[model samples]
Target: MILGRDEANKALRAQHGQRGTQARRAAAASVIGTTIEWYDFFLYNTAAALIFPAVFFPESSSYAGAMQSFATYAVGFAARPVGAAIFGYWGDRIGRKTTLIITLLLMGIASGVIGVLPGTDSIGIVAPIMLVVLRLIQGIAVGGEWSGSVLLAMEWGDQRKRGLLASFAQMGVPMGLVLGTGGMTLLSALLPAESFTSWGWRIPFLASLVLVAVGLVIRLRILETPMFAAVVAERRTSSKPVTDAVKHHWREILLSAGLRFSEQMPFYLFTSFVLVYAVEERDLSKTFVLNAVLVAAAIELATIPLFSRLSDSIGRKRVYLSGAILVGALAFPYFAVLKDGSALAIFLIVIASMIPHAMQYGPQAALIGESFPTHLRYGGAGLGYQLASVFAGGPAPLLATWLLHSTGTPFSISAYIVFSAVVTVVCVIVLPDRSRADITDDNVYARTPGKHRTSS
Candidate 1:
């Protein structure tokens, strides 16, 4: 009897092993779903910087229109935290898979609607108002999307490769950037300027529908994460996860938000604001700036995964802090390089900027997700990450543009980047490295005596 039981247990373990095909499929689903969602979100950034000012917000001066359009873009970031709270609650209370599916559907519909929206020429003031509303919907959807993707991929793998698996989801950022920029680049090249500005810009937004269809099929088929399943089996799921996360994991929440400052600021500067700066300040062609962003995004596709895998070996903090420090050091050089007005020089600058951004972003999901216990992980990570969008990501382009316009130089933008980087380094120093922690439960609460940890 004892020999028969031992054999049955071994067979069961083999059947349910995480290293099997199911893990790979789950990881793929996380990446695919997020890639589609981000493709939709980022499509807006490209439009806000390039096409929206003329089409949606017609002001007395081009600069005013561009700044106004960017303000609308910031509205989306403002709404993100709201989305995080709503979806984060459900994601923690129910499951990651279900919440992710909802977010994907929401983003697809909003983006497709934007494609068909009439501009200021046709609809008067209503056009920009409608644009801001749809952008908010997109914001909420993306606000919910990131935490679920991170947790879904991270939970499917064991500790040994957790950072690497979590980064499979992070890869979606660059994938979306490539798709958004590549599509815009192609259409802008193929169409004449009038046609491209009038209708061609809508193609990328409309394309979100098709990607969402495929993402939905894949996401619907994947299983709920094993960590959440175990929580359910033990009846340890939190009823109000968002509230609990605020009360218990507030330090992690603040630290995660702070860590995002440098990462998020340089990202918008590199990808979004660079178009305006290069064209208006340096007299560079729009095509050249777009192509630069495309190449940098492509390089990130390789670098993000490489850095993430490195984190799995050395440590998350070392990789994250190094990236933060690099951003500060390069802040001044970034402006100096751009002033040369050469295409090759701008391309090199764009590509170089992504290296530090990816180094932090690659391992960022696991770093934040691991800080909280399993039940509150979704809510904690989502709130922290989305909150950063308000202070860091949303204001970055607007601030950069204002500084350039006010000071008549890029030095203000450089100072801004350095300040944000300092905040990130400080947060990195304070936040604990939980790379080896068992996140399967709140079990760590018992192990850390006198710590303010909580158990479900």
Candidate 2:
């Protein structure tokens, strides 16, 4: 049974090639699963802005009801950090794929429940309470989904292509936004206003069930990431991954929270609050705002991948820094265009706003995932990113609405977005250039000689 040296070498090469194929398959599956998860999540946000206030909070004054509904929407974001801490521990200790499957199922069920739930007319006070509960569950599920999916992609990719592969998972954001908004727009057009207000809004939520099934099927076929396997084999899994992340990687966690604050805050402002702002403040039609977002999302689908590729060549920090700076400078100008209340003005603002957003978003997944080690990657990244939702994504729409109502000027809201961008610029400047780091080496936890310890 003894083999020649050439035959042994051939066998080793064949095994390595198979592993590469499996890794690519795993990465692709992760991307698609995250896309489905985000699609459901974004659909809820769109509904909150457009319909939930009328359906669930009918007892309050119109403006008060809108704010209250948005508060429920924020509840999901607030729940995200808590979800990250909980699911992240299991993901880092038990397995990434297992955690992702659970999250996907949880989110799907929560979204489907919302689609079928009776409104206040049928259930009275219990309706809003049930809505809030479902939103919390969705938030928690999504909190774990992003980190697990991104880590799966990053761990499976070649070190040089890590940024590109990880960013593929993030492509879900714009893809989901486009699909959710586009579907709503189409449905809105087909149905009479009364029908849409009565039952048409439920279609998008119900559609999530189909997407969730498809996502589960795709994810079930993929093997676990090689990095997580190595951690398991070495018996180096952290007993408390969340604790370890906080103890050693706290600064990275803080920076990550701040870095995302700018990107996510402005996103909710543009995509969610802007819809309400246009319809109520500018007297623009619902279809106009919906179509504008669809166009912007289409641009994001193309631009996100391009920026991700660009990050591979120029470095993530460089690309991210430029994006933060551009967004900070453009915040006021973007809102200024919206002031005109013309379709052309809305189009210009949407395109301008999303372009900078895409630049930062393109390389974002890899940049965040690269900040942590293999054993703690999912927990660390998830906690950091989800916690940012509290001040960033969760409160953004509410904050924008409050500012506009109080000041009667969009300039106050623009200032809030600009402030977040400034924080991101500072954080990006301090992050290490991971593009040149030896990411494939298993000794990721070992501090490089002369390099200060990085925050998680």
Candidate 3:
């Protein structure tokens, strides 16, 4: 099954019409699919912070309601690893295109169901339980979607621009942030407070159905990656790729999760938790914070690609570590700016903060994807990436909420951010660096110069 170089080229050439054009199409599909999926996902984050406690947990006091709501939000994060395992197996076995399509549908439908669900008044306890279940479905679908989108984009493009192509998949986070936050802001502004809470919130969730339809059409037209085709032609795929990834590449999986602690934890704090902190504590307008976060996300649309492109010349580890440090350094100052409560200062700092995040996130897809070969890449990358949701991104709002009330100080949350940065810096130093190695090696996993193979 180890084809000669010529045969490998033939297999790749045989699978598609034009390599350059298809690669672009694949990247486009990745952007659209990931954007739609994250739009659905971010809607939940925004709602959990701004809308859910009042709707689903109306019986509880403010603190208790917020905590309970975020706990449901965290349920989705807890389910991500399981999703990674299930979808990773199918994605690695059948193909990225089909697995991604399944994930898009699952996420879209879950969001739509949330849109129609009865509130606590209508359904009593069943309402919150149903919400949690749908959140889990959303989490699982997203857990699988991220790596597939990245691979669809990265594997189809020129190897030398892996960082840039990988960032195309990453573009969804900020773009979706803008769309979700913008949608929420627009509705809240347009409707009465009662009406907005009761029904206006559901519009964004319902919109996901239409977006998913468009994403499916784009994804269907794109072929599977040539790299994956080579894997199939070489007959190199495992029946249980997710299991093998955990069994053989546990180090990569764990370290990859660790590397995102700084990135993911702070992202939620900035985008989700800050909305609560600004409105409840600082007495800032909800619309103002939402608009500020919206602007920050738009800025990342530029910064994410720039930093990722820079990683092509430098290294993934370097860009990522620098981001971790910068984000950590900015943490204390970020809150300090909020404490000052100048509208201009808060907006300026909020917009400036996401650039550091882009530095880590832009290069993140390829950085993790390079840890495993094509046969195991989907499951391996997905498991590692999604595992962070449980410990990092998912718990961030809950943790920030707790820290705020317990310590009665904004700086307590900043300390938590710094801890995440420390973990990330230490983890990246220890994880393998394969940014320069050949990613398309089918016979054996590629190794860096002066290295033979990765140590178990």
- The residue-by-residue lDDT of candidate 3 on 57-173, one tens digit each, is 998898998899889989999999889998888887778888899999999999999999999999899999999999999999998899999999899888899999999999999
Which lDDT tens digits does candidate 1 get at residues 1-456? 011223323323433863466577788998998899888888899899889988987763788988898998999999898999999989876688788999999999999999999999898989989999999999999999999999887887666888889998899998998899889989988999999999999999999999999999998776677677666555566777898888888888899999999999889999999999888878888888888888888898899889888998998999999999999999999999898647788889888999999999998988898888877888899999999999999988998888988998898899999999999999989988877777764666332223322224
Give the per-residue Cα lDDT of candidate 2 at 241. Answer: 79
lDDT value, residue 30 of candidate 2: 77
Worst 10 residues of 1 by lDDT: 1-10
Instruction: List per-prediction Cα lDDT, in the order shown.
Output: 0.86, 0.83, 0.88
- The predictions' CA RMSDs to the true structure, in order, are 4.8, 5.2, 3.8
- Ranking according to TM-score, highest score first: 3, 1, 2
Worst 10 residues of 2 by lDDT: 447-456
- Looking at model 2, residue 271 earns an lDDT score of 93
